[model samples]
Target: MSAEHTASAPAGPLWRLALGRSLGRSRKFLWFLLINILPLYVASDLLVTSGALAKISGFLEPVMSLWGLPPEAAAVLLAGMLVNLYAATAVAAPLALSWQQVSVLGLILGIAHSLIMEAVVVRQLTRRYHALTLLRIVLGLGAGWLLALVLC
Candidate 1:
Protein backbone atom coordinates (compact mmCIF):
# COMPACT_ATOMS: atom_id res chain seq x y z
CA MET A 1 0.00 0.00 0.00
CA SER A 2 1.22 3.56 -0.79
CA ALA A 3 2.24 5.62 2.34
CA GLU A 4 -0.10 8.58 1.58
CA HIS A 5 -3.08 6.34 0.84
CA THR A 6 -2.62 4.34 4.11
CA ALA A 7 -2.34 7.58 6.18
CA SER A 8 -5.51 9.12 4.68
CA ALA A 9 -7.55 5.98 5.13
CA PRO A 10 -6.65 5.73 8.83
CA ALA A 11 -7.45 9.40 9.44
CA GLY A 12 -10.90 9.17 7.86
CA PRO A 13 -11.82 6.02 9.74
CA LEU A 14 -10.49 7.42 13.02
CA TRP A 15 -12.71 10.51 12.77
CA ARG A 16 -15.79 8.43 12.10
CA LEU A 17 -14.91 6.05 14.94
CA ALA A 18 -14.54 8.91 17.42
CA LEU A 19 -17.87 10.41 16.34
CA GLY A 20 -19.64 7.07 16.73
CA ARG A 21 -18.16 6.53 20.20
CA SER A 22 -19.22 10.00 21.33
CA LEU A 23 -22.79 9.43 20.13
CA GLY A 24 -22.96 6.17 22.05
CA ARG A 25 -21.76 7.93 25.21
CA SER A 26 -24.37 10.67 24.77
CA ARG A 27 -27.17 8.13 24.48
CA LYS A 28 -25.97 6.35 27.65
CA PHE A 29 -25.92 9.61 29.57
CA LEU A 30 -29.45 10.44 28.41
CA TRP A 31 -30.66 7.09 29.71
CA PHE A 32 -28.83 7.68 33.01
CA LEU A 33 -30.61 11.01 33.44
CA LEU A 34 -34.00 9.46 32.76
CA ILE A 35 -33.41 6.65 35.26
CA ASN A 36 -31.73 8.60 38.06
CA ILE A 37 -32.53 12.31 37.94
CA LEU A 38 -36.21 12.02 36.97
CA PRO A 39 -37.16 9.92 39.99
CA LEU A 40 -35.24 12.21 42.35
CA TYR A 41 -37.15 15.21 41.00
CA VAL A 42 -40.47 13.47 41.49
CA ALA A 43 -39.64 12.33 45.03
CA SER A 44 -38.49 15.81 46.01
CA ASP A 45 -41.77 17.25 44.71
CA LEU A 46 -43.77 14.73 46.71
CA LEU A 47 -41.84 15.52 49.91
CA VAL A 48 -42.75 19.18 49.54
CA THR A 49 -46.40 18.49 48.73
CA SER A 50 -47.05 15.98 51.50
CA GLY A 51 -45.64 18.12 54.35
CA ALA A 52 -43.47 15.19 55.42
CA LEU A 53 -40.49 17.42 54.84
CA ALA A 54 -41.80 19.85 57.42
CA LYS A 55 -42.01 17.09 59.98
CA ILE A 56 -38.43 16.11 59.22
CA SER A 57 -37.34 19.74 59.52
CA GLY A 58 -39.10 20.09 62.86
CA PHE A 59 -37.27 17.10 64.22
CA LEU A 60 -33.92 18.49 63.12
CA GLU A 61 -34.59 22.05 64.28
CA PRO A 62 -32.34 22.11 67.34
CA VAL A 63 -29.36 20.65 65.51
CA MET A 64 -29.77 23.03 62.59
CA SER A 65 -30.32 26.00 64.88
CA LEU A 66 -26.87 25.38 66.29
CA TRP A 67 -25.42 26.15 62.85
CA GLY A 68 -27.39 29.42 62.63
CA LEU A 69 -29.82 27.96 60.10
CA PRO A 70 -33.59 27.76 60.26
CA PRO A 71 -35.34 24.44 60.95
CA GLU A 72 -36.41 24.30 57.30
CA ALA A 73 -32.77 24.46 56.23
CA ALA A 74 -32.32 20.94 57.59
CA ALA A 75 -34.43 19.55 54.80
CA VAL A 76 -32.34 21.27 52.16
CA LEU A 77 -29.07 19.97 53.61
CA LEU A 78 -30.45 16.46 54.02
CA ALA A 79 -31.79 16.44 50.49
CA GLY A 80 -28.49 17.70 49.11
CA MET A 81 -26.46 15.07 50.92
CA LEU A 82 -28.84 12.18 50.25
CA VAL A 83 -29.91 12.99 46.70
CA ASN A 84 -28.24 15.88 44.79
CA LEU A 85 -28.15 19.67 44.41
CA TYR A 86 -31.39 19.69 42.38
CA ALA A 87 -33.27 17.99 45.20
CA ALA A 88 -31.78 20.44 47.69
CA THR A 89 -32.89 23.42 45.60
CA ALA A 90 -36.39 22.04 45.29
CA VAL A 91 -36.59 21.94 49.11
CA ALA A 92 -34.92 25.34 49.50
CA ALA A 93 -37.00 27.42 47.05
CA PRO A 94 -40.12 27.80 49.20
CA LEU A 95 -38.28 28.48 52.46
CA ALA A 96 -37.50 32.16 51.77
CA LEU A 97 -34.08 32.05 53.38
CA SER A 98 -32.10 35.18 54.16
CA TRP A 99 -28.96 35.93 52.17
CA GLN A 100 -26.75 34.80 55.05
CA GLN A 101 -28.59 31.50 55.41
CA VAL A 102 -28.40 30.83 51.70
CA SER A 103 -24.70 31.58 51.63
CA VAL A 104 -24.01 29.20 54.49
CA LEU A 105 -26.16 26.46 52.98
CA GLY A 106 -24.50 26.92 49.62
CA LEU A 107 -21.05 26.59 51.13
CA ILE A 108 -21.95 23.46 53.09
CA LEU A 109 -23.75 21.68 50.30
CA GLY A 110 -21.03 22.53 47.82
CA ILE A 111 -18.61 20.69 50.03
CA ALA A 112 -20.68 17.59 50.78
CA HIS A 113 -23.58 16.81 48.50
CA SER A 114 -24.72 13.45 47.00
CA LEU A 115 -23.11 11.33 49.67
CA ILE A 116 -24.45 7.92 48.61
CA MET A 117 -23.76 8.16 44.89
CA GLU A 118 -20.50 9.99 45.45
CA ALA A 119 -19.35 7.57 48.09
CA VAL A 120 -19.67 4.75 45.58
CA VAL A 121 -17.55 6.74 43.13
CA VAL A 122 -15.07 7.51 45.90
CA ARG A 123 -14.87 3.84 46.85
CA GLN A 124 -14.09 2.94 43.27
CA LEU A 125 -11.29 5.49 43.15
CA THR A 126 -9.72 4.97 46.57
CA ARG A 127 -9.65 2.58 49.50
CA ARG A 128 -10.23 5.40 52.02
CA TYR A 129 -13.82 6.10 51.13
CA HIS A 130 -15.04 6.03 54.75
CA ALA A 131 -12.45 8.53 55.92
CA LEU A 132 -12.99 10.80 52.96
CA THR A 133 -16.76 10.75 53.46
CA LEU A 134 -16.38 11.62 57.15
CA LEU A 135 -13.92 14.39 56.31
CA ARG A 136 -16.32 15.91 53.79
CA ILE A 137 -19.16 16.08 56.31
CA VAL A 138 -16.93 17.64 58.95
CA LEU A 139 -15.48 20.14 56.52
CA GLY A 140 -18.92 21.10 55.25
CA LEU A 141 -20.18 21.73 58.79
CA GLY A 142 -17.09 23.73 59.71
CA ALA A 143 -17.36 25.83 56.58
CA GLY A 144 -21.03 26.51 57.21
CA TRP A 145 -20.29 27.60 60.78
CA LEU A 146 -17.53 29.92 59.61
CA LEU A 147 -19.76 31.41 56.92
CA ALA A 148 -22.53 31.95 59.46
CA LEU A 149 -20.08 33.81 61.70
CA VAL A 150 -19.11 36.12 58.85
CA LEU A 151 -22.41 36.43 56.94
CA CYS A 152 -24.94 36.11 59.74
Candidate 2:
Protein backbone atom coordinates (compact mmCIF):
# COMPACT_ATOMS: atom_id res chain seq x y z
CA MET A 1 0.00 0.00 0.00
CA SER A 2 1.11 3.53 -0.66
CA ALA A 3 2.26 5.59 2.36
CA GLU A 4 -0.75 7.88 2.06
CA HIS A 5 -3.20 4.95 1.81
CA THR A 6 -1.63 3.16 4.81
CA ALA A 7 -1.53 6.33 6.89
CA SER A 8 -5.22 6.94 6.24
CA ALA A 9 -6.27 3.29 6.50
CA PRO A 10 -9.82 2.74 7.75
CA ALA A 11 -8.67 -0.02 10.14
CA GLY A 12 -5.29 0.38 11.77
CA PRO A 13 -3.23 -2.45 13.20
CA LEU A 14 -5.38 -4.63 15.44
CA TRP A 15 -2.79 -4.96 18.22
CA ARG A 16 -2.35 -1.21 18.53
CA LEU A 17 -6.09 -0.69 18.99
CA ALA A 18 -6.30 -3.50 21.49
CA LEU A 19 -3.33 -2.18 23.47
CA GLY A 20 -4.81 1.28 23.63
CA ARG A 21 -8.14 -0.01 24.84
CA SER A 22 -6.50 -2.20 27.46
CA LEU A 23 -4.41 0.71 28.73
CA GLY A 24 -7.52 2.80 29.12
CA ARG A 25 -9.18 -0.01 31.04
CA SER A 26 -6.15 -0.44 33.27
CA ARG A 27 -6.16 3.22 34.19
CA LYS A 28 -9.81 2.99 35.25
CA PHE A 29 -9.06 -0.17 37.20
CA LEU A 30 -6.24 1.52 39.09
CA TRP A 31 -8.51 4.35 40.04
CA PHE A 32 -11.17 1.94 41.20
CA LEU A 33 -8.66 0.05 43.31
CA LEU A 34 -7.37 3.20 44.99
CA ILE A 35 -10.83 4.52 45.74
CA ASN A 36 -12.07 1.27 47.22
CA ILE A 37 -8.96 0.17 49.07
CA LEU A 38 -7.83 3.39 50.74
CA PRO A 39 -10.90 3.68 52.94
CA LEU A 40 -10.70 0.03 53.92
CA TYR A 41 -7.09 0.42 55.01
CA VAL A 42 -7.89 3.47 57.12
CA ALA A 43 -10.88 1.78 58.68
CA SER A 44 -8.91 -1.34 59.44
CA ASP A 45 -6.19 0.70 61.12
CA LEU A 46 -8.72 2.59 63.22
CA LEU A 47 -10.43 -0.61 64.26
CA VAL A 48 -7.13 -2.14 65.31
CA THR A 49 -6.00 0.94 67.23
CA SER A 50 -9.28 1.36 69.09
CA GLY A 51 -9.19 -2.21 70.44
CA ALA A 52 -12.54 -2.87 68.77
CA LEU A 53 -10.88 -5.45 66.60
CA ALA A 54 -9.86 -7.46 69.65
CA LYS A 55 -13.38 -7.38 71.02
CA ILE A 56 -14.80 -8.52 67.73
CA SER A 57 -12.18 -11.18 67.41
CA GLY A 58 -12.98 -12.47 70.88
CA PHE A 59 -16.65 -12.69 69.99
CA LEU A 60 -15.80 -14.60 66.84
CA GLU A 61 -13.35 -17.00 68.47
CA PRO A 62 -15.72 -19.93 68.72
CA VAL A 63 -16.88 -19.54 65.17
CA MET A 64 -13.31 -19.28 63.89
CA SER A 65 -12.31 -22.39 65.82
CA LEU A 66 -14.78 -24.31 63.68
CA TRP A 67 -12.61 -23.42 60.68
CA GLY A 68 -9.36 -24.10 62.54
CA LEU A 69 -8.39 -20.42 62.34
CA PRO A 70 -7.61 -18.02 65.16
CA PRO A 71 -10.25 -15.58 66.41
CA GLU A 72 -8.50 -12.67 64.70
CA ALA A 73 -8.77 -14.48 61.40
CA ALA A 74 -12.45 -13.63 61.51
CA ALA A 75 -11.59 -9.99 60.97
CA VAL A 76 -9.54 -10.89 57.93
CA LEU A 77 -12.34 -12.96 56.47
CA LEU A 78 -14.86 -10.24 57.21
CA ALA A 79 -12.66 -7.59 55.65
CA GLY A 80 -12.21 -9.68 52.55
CA MET A 81 -15.91 -10.30 52.16
CA LEU A 82 -16.96 -6.78 52.93
CA VAL A 83 -14.20 -4.79 51.25
CA ASN A 84 -11.48 -6.62 49.31
CA LEU A 85 -8.27 -8.63 49.58
CA TYR A 86 -6.25 -5.53 50.52
CA ALA A 87 -8.54 -4.96 53.46
CA ALA A 88 -8.21 -8.60 54.47
CA THR A 89 -4.43 -8.38 54.28
CA ALA A 90 -4.49 -5.32 56.47
CA VAL A 91 -6.32 -7.33 59.10
CA ALA A 92 -4.18 -10.44 58.69
CA ALA A 93 -0.83 -8.64 58.68
CA PRO A 94 -0.78 -7.99 62.43
CA LEU A 95 -1.83 -11.48 63.39
CA ALA A 96 0.33 -14.55 63.90
CA LEU A 97 -0.86 -17.35 61.66
CA SER A 98 0.76 -20.51 60.42
CA TRP A 99 1.33 -20.98 56.73
CA GLN A 100 -1.39 -23.61 56.69
CA GLN A 101 -3.92 -21.22 58.21
CA VAL A 102 -3.04 -18.47 55.74
CA SER A 103 -3.30 -20.91 52.87
CA VAL A 104 -6.77 -22.03 53.94
CA LEU A 105 -7.86 -18.44 54.36
CA GLY A 106 -6.50 -17.64 50.93
CA LEU A 107 -8.50 -20.44 49.39
CA ILE A 108 -11.68 -19.24 51.06
CA LEU A 109 -11.27 -15.58 50.21
CA GLY A 110 -10.31 -16.41 46.66
CA ILE A 111 -13.70 -17.91 46.18
CA ALA A 112 -15.62 -15.17 47.90
CA HIS A 113 -14.57 -11.57 48.56
CA SER A 114 -15.91 -8.09 47.84
CA LEU A 115 -19.42 -9.47 48.00
CA ILE A 116 -21.36 -6.22 48.01
CA MET A 117 -19.45 -4.59 45.17
CA GLU A 118 -19.20 -7.77 43.15
CA ALA A 119 -22.82 -8.64 43.75
CA VAL A 120 -23.83 -5.28 42.36
CA VAL A 121 -21.72 -5.89 39.27
CA VAL A 122 -23.11 -9.40 38.94
CA ARG A 123 -26.63 -8.13 39.36
CA GLN A 124 -26.14 -5.65 36.54
CA LEU A 125 -24.81 -8.32 34.23
CA THR A 126 -26.63 -11.52 35.23
CA ARG A 127 -29.66 -10.34 37.20
CA ARG A 128 -29.06 -13.17 39.70
CA TYR A 129 -26.99 -11.44 42.31
CA HIS A 130 -28.64 -13.16 45.27
CA ALA A 131 -28.01 -16.65 43.97
CA LEU A 132 -24.46 -15.95 42.91
CA THR A 133 -23.66 -14.26 46.20
CA LEU A 134 -25.01 -17.21 48.18
CA LEU A 135 -23.14 -19.66 46.02
CA ARG A 136 -19.86 -17.81 46.46
CA ILE A 137 -20.24 -17.69 50.25
CA VAL A 138 -21.14 -21.37 50.42
CA LEU A 139 -18.25 -22.36 48.20
CA GLY A 140 -15.79 -20.27 50.16
CA LEU A 141 -16.92 -21.73 53.46
CA GLY A 142 -16.95 -25.25 52.11
CA ALA A 143 -13.48 -24.90 50.64
CA GLY A 144 -12.15 -23.40 53.86
CA TRP A 145 -13.70 -26.19 55.89
CA LEU A 146 -12.23 -28.86 53.64
CA LEU A 147 -8.80 -27.26 53.69
CA ALA A 148 -8.91 -26.97 57.47
CA LEU A 149 -9.80 -30.61 57.80
CA VAL A 150 -6.83 -31.62 55.68
CA LEU A 151 -4.31 -29.08 56.88
CA CYS A 152 -5.17 -28.63 60.55
Candidate 3:
Protein backbone atom coordinates (compact mmCIF):
# COMPACT_ATOMS: atom_id res chain seq x y z
CA MET A 1 0.00 0.00 0.00
CA SER A 2 2.78 2.36 0.86
CA ALA A 3 4.50 1.49 -2.41
CA GLU A 4 1.29 2.15 -4.30
CA HIS A 5 0.86 5.46 -2.53
CA THR A 6 4.44 6.40 -3.30
CA ALA A 7 3.96 5.44 -6.92
CA SER A 8 0.88 7.63 -7.29
CA ALA A 9 2.03 10.56 -5.19
CA PRO A 10 4.04 13.20 -7.03
CA ALA A 11 6.21 16.10 -5.95
CA GLY A 12 3.74 18.64 -7.35
CA PRO A 13 -0.01 19.41 -7.27
CA LEU A 14 -2.45 16.63 -8.12
CA TRP A 15 -4.42 19.08 -10.26
CA ARG A 16 -1.49 19.42 -12.62
CA LEU A 17 -1.45 15.70 -13.30
CA ALA A 18 -5.21 15.59 -13.66
CA LEU A 19 -5.15 18.58 -15.95
CA GLY A 20 -2.44 17.03 -18.06
CA ARG A 21 -4.37 13.80 -18.46
CA SER A 22 -7.62 15.64 -19.16
CA LEU A 23 -5.95 17.92 -21.68
CA GLY A 24 -4.48 14.89 -23.38
CA ARG A 25 -8.05 13.68 -23.79
CA SER A 26 -9.54 17.12 -24.27
CA ARG A 27 -11.16 16.21 -27.57
CA LYS A 28 -12.96 13.25 -26.06
CA PHE A 29 -14.20 15.36 -23.14
CA LEU A 30 -15.31 18.14 -25.43
CA TRP A 31 -17.24 15.80 -27.69
CA PHE A 32 -18.72 14.09 -24.66
CA LEU A 33 -19.86 17.43 -23.28
CA LEU A 34 -21.27 18.53 -26.61
CA ILE A 35 -23.25 15.37 -27.30
CA ASN A 36 -24.44 14.86 -23.73
CA ILE A 37 -24.51 18.03 -21.63
CA LEU A 38 -25.82 20.56 -24.11
CA PRO A 39 -28.75 18.39 -25.08
CA LEU A 40 -29.67 17.66 -21.48
CA TYR A 41 -29.75 21.33 -20.60
CA VAL A 42 -32.02 22.06 -23.50
CA ALA A 43 -34.29 19.15 -22.73
CA SER A 44 -34.48 19.94 -19.03
CA ASP A 45 -35.39 23.54 -19.69
CA LEU A 46 -38.07 22.53 -22.18
CA LEU A 47 -39.54 19.80 -20.01
CA VAL A 48 -39.82 22.04 -16.99
CA THR A 49 -41.40 24.80 -18.96
CA SER A 50 -43.75 22.40 -20.69
CA GLY A 51 -45.51 21.34 -17.48
CA ALA A 52 -43.82 17.96 -17.08
CA LEU A 53 -41.84 19.32 -14.20
CA ALA A 54 -44.93 20.78 -12.63
CA LYS A 55 -46.61 17.42 -12.65
CA ILE A 56 -43.56 15.81 -11.21
CA SER A 57 -43.21 18.52 -8.62
CA GLY A 58 -46.80 18.05 -7.58
CA PHE A 59 -46.11 14.40 -6.94
CA LEU A 60 -42.90 15.16 -5.07
CA GLU A 61 -44.22 18.01 -2.95
CA PRO A 62 -45.54 15.92 -0.10
CA VAL A 63 -42.36 13.91 0.13
CA MET A 64 -40.00 16.81 -0.44
CA SER A 65 -41.79 18.98 2.10
CA LEU A 66 -40.60 16.58 4.76
CA TRP A 67 -37.11 17.92 4.02
CA GLY A 68 -38.27 21.52 3.92
CA LEU A 69 -37.93 21.73 0.15
CA PRO A 70 -40.74 23.12 -1.89
CA PRO A 71 -42.14 21.57 -5.06
CA GLU A 72 -40.27 24.06 -7.26
CA ALA A 73 -37.09 22.24 -6.38
CA ALA A 74 -38.13 19.51 -8.80
CA ALA A 75 -37.20 21.75 -11.70
CA VAL A 76 -33.62 22.11 -10.58
CA LEU A 77 -33.67 18.52 -9.36
CA LEU A 78 -33.76 17.42 -12.98
CA ALA A 79 -31.08 19.82 -14.11
CA GLY A 80 -27.43 20.03 -13.03
CA MET A 81 -26.75 23.52 -14.32
CA LEU A 82 -25.32 24.45 -10.95
CA VAL A 83 -21.71 23.87 -9.99
CA ASN A 84 -22.27 24.47 -6.27
CA LEU A 85 -25.67 22.84 -6.29
CA TYR A 86 -26.77 26.21 -7.61
CA ALA A 87 -30.18 25.32 -9.03
CA ALA A 88 -31.70 24.07 -5.82
CA THR A 89 -29.97 26.77 -3.84
CA ALA A 90 -31.34 29.37 -6.22
CA VAL A 91 -34.87 28.18 -5.58
CA ALA A 92 -34.50 27.63 -1.86
CA ALA A 93 -32.33 30.68 -1.25
CA PRO A 94 -35.04 33.19 -2.10
CA LEU A 95 -37.51 31.46 0.14
CA ALA A 96 -37.47 31.72 3.90
CA LEU A 97 -35.21 28.71 4.11
CA SER A 98 -34.05 27.55 7.49
CA TRP A 99 -30.57 26.13 7.81
CA GLN A 100 -32.16 22.72 7.70
CA GLN A 101 -33.80 23.38 4.37
CA VAL A 102 -30.61 24.83 2.97
CA SER A 103 -28.61 21.90 4.26
CA VAL A 104 -31.12 19.42 2.91
CA LEU A 105 -30.97 20.99 -0.54
CA GLY A 106 -27.23 21.14 -0.33
CA LEU A 107 -26.82 17.51 0.67
CA ILE A 108 -29.44 16.00 -1.61
CA LEU A 109 -28.30 17.82 -4.72
CA GLY A 110 -24.70 17.55 -3.63
CA ILE A 111 -25.30 13.91 -4.49
CA ALA A 112 -28.10 13.46 -6.99
CA HIS A 113 -29.47 14.81 -10.34
CA SER A 114 -28.08 15.16 -13.84
CA LEU A 115 -28.29 11.40 -13.71
CA ILE A 116 -28.77 10.77 -17.42
CA MET A 117 -25.47 11.81 -18.95
CA GLU A 118 -23.40 12.64 -15.88
CA ALA A 119 -23.97 9.11 -14.69
CA VAL A 120 -22.71 7.90 -18.04
CA VAL A 121 -19.59 10.00 -17.66
CA VAL A 122 -19.12 8.74 -14.13
CA ARG A 123 -19.59 5.18 -15.29
CA GLN A 124 -17.11 5.59 -18.07
CA LEU A 125 -14.60 7.14 -15.72
CA THR A 126 -15.09 4.50 -12.99
CA ARG A 127 -15.61 1.39 -15.14
CA ARG A 128 -19.29 0.66 -15.55
CA TYR A 129 -20.63 1.70 -12.16
CA HIS A 130 -24.41 1.68 -11.83
CA ALA A 131 -24.57 0.91 -8.14
CA LEU A 132 -22.57 3.96 -7.05
CA THR A 133 -24.95 6.22 -8.94
CA LEU A 134 -27.95 4.69 -7.25
CA LEU A 135 -26.20 4.79 -3.92
CA ARG A 136 -25.47 8.49 -4.43
CA ILE A 137 -29.10 9.26 -5.16
CA VAL A 138 -30.24 7.34 -2.11
CA LEU A 139 -27.60 8.90 0.07
CA GLY A 140 -28.43 12.33 -1.24
CA LEU A 141 -32.07 11.91 -0.38
CA GLY A 142 -31.47 10.42 3.04
CA ALA A 143 -28.61 12.68 4.00
CA GLY A 144 -30.33 15.84 2.83
CA TRP A 145 -33.58 15.06 4.56
CA LEU A 146 -31.78 14.01 7.70
CA LEU A 147 -29.73 17.17 7.70
CA ALA A 148 -32.88 19.19 7.29
CA LEU A 149 -34.51 17.53 10.24
CA VAL A 150 -31.49 17.95 12.43
CA LEU A 151 -30.57 21.46 11.38
CA CYS A 152 -34.03 22.90 11.03
TM-score of each: 0.66, 0.69, 0.51
lDDT of each: 0.82, 0.84, 0.65
Residue pair clashes in candidate 2: none
- Candidate 1 C-alpha lDDT tens digits along 69-91: 87767878988999888778766
Candidate 2 residue lDDT tens string, 1-152: 56763334447786786677789999997887688666666776777678777787787878898789978788899889998887787678656679989999999999999999999889888978899999999999999999999999
Model 1: runs farther than 4 Å from truth?
A: 1-56
Output the number of the TM-score-best candidate: 2
lDDT of 3: 0.65
Candidates 1 and 3 compared: the better one by TM-score is 1
lDDT top scorer = 2
- Stretches of candidate 3 off by over 4 Å are 1-59, 81-96
Weakest ten-residue segment in model 1 by summed lDDT: 3-12
Error of 2 at 148 (Å): 0.6
Q: What is the C-alpha RMSD of each candidate to the true structure, in Å?
A: 6.4, 6.1, 7.2
**TM-score-superior candidate, 1 or 2:** 2
lDDT of 3 by residue, 1-152 (tens): 46554337685777787777679799886876677656655665665567665576787888678777767565555543233343444434334556666567767887776666577688777865688778878898888777877876
